[model samples]
Target: MPPDALALYATVILLLPMACFFLSSPTFLLVGLEIPEVTQLLRGLFNGYFIVMCVAGVASAVAYVISGRPVFAVGALAVAAVAVMARRWFLQHMDVELQARAAGEAAAVPRLRALHLKGMLLNGILLATVIANVPLVV
Candidate 1:
């Protein structure tokens, strides 16, 4: 692919997840929904978001490789790995903690909150990484 096309792909890969993050975040509370409902909605939204991230990551990696940018390719692959880990481990742990909290295990509440915060931090880092790379990739 041409360099411009590759840059466009990279931009899409980075921006789409950011958009999803904003849409599913605590700001959803402004719509007047209950906390549990927002949590449930975000959980479902993230299921799709993770899949999107995985696809976008792979596509970005391939684009980078085609554009002769091996470092960017590796970074994209790392993003994909993180996406998989977030989906498999972090999300599952959050679900388990949520269930435990529902079962009256008070300790699970803090753990769940921590997991959410970690996820937010991870997203922030990922976004920053993409932003930092955008100029070089373009």
Candidate 2:
């Protein structure tokens, strides 16, 4: 396979979760987060997002290295690193909020929403950063 093709696949992999989030997030606004099933679905979505981000980042890094773009490789690695750190932090905080909510805390649901929004915000930033690098790869 060609280097460019590999890079394209990597980029697509990285962007896919963001694309899904764009469609999935607004629906969260309509649902009651207090529902156990809703919280479960939301948590699953977040878990998958982070997992994909980690995999895509590493794939992109490998693609960059194969394509002889070591600087971009470093950037890709950074993306993966961020995903790794963010996943641990995000999930931990989320679990805390979920537990609190289960325990009948009034503020827990709102706090979870806030965390969701922050994750979405980070997604936007990452998407923009990845797109910005596309031209250089081209």
Candidate 1's C-alpha lDDT?
Answer: 0.74
Candidate 2 accuracy as TM-score? 0.92
Candidate 2: which stretches are off by over 4 Å? none
Q: Identify the leading candidate in terms of lDDT.
A: 2
lDDT of 1 by residue, 23-116 (tens): 5665643542225576677667667767888888888888878877878888888888888888888779868877887778878756766666
> Which stretches of model 1 miss by more than 4 angstroms?
28-36
Error of 1 at 14 (Å): 2.7
lDDT, candidate 2, residue 133?
A: 76
Clashes of each: 0, 0
Query: Tens digit of lDDT per residue, candidate 2, span 35-130?
Result: 989988888888888888888888888887887778888988888898889888889999999999999999999999998888888888988998
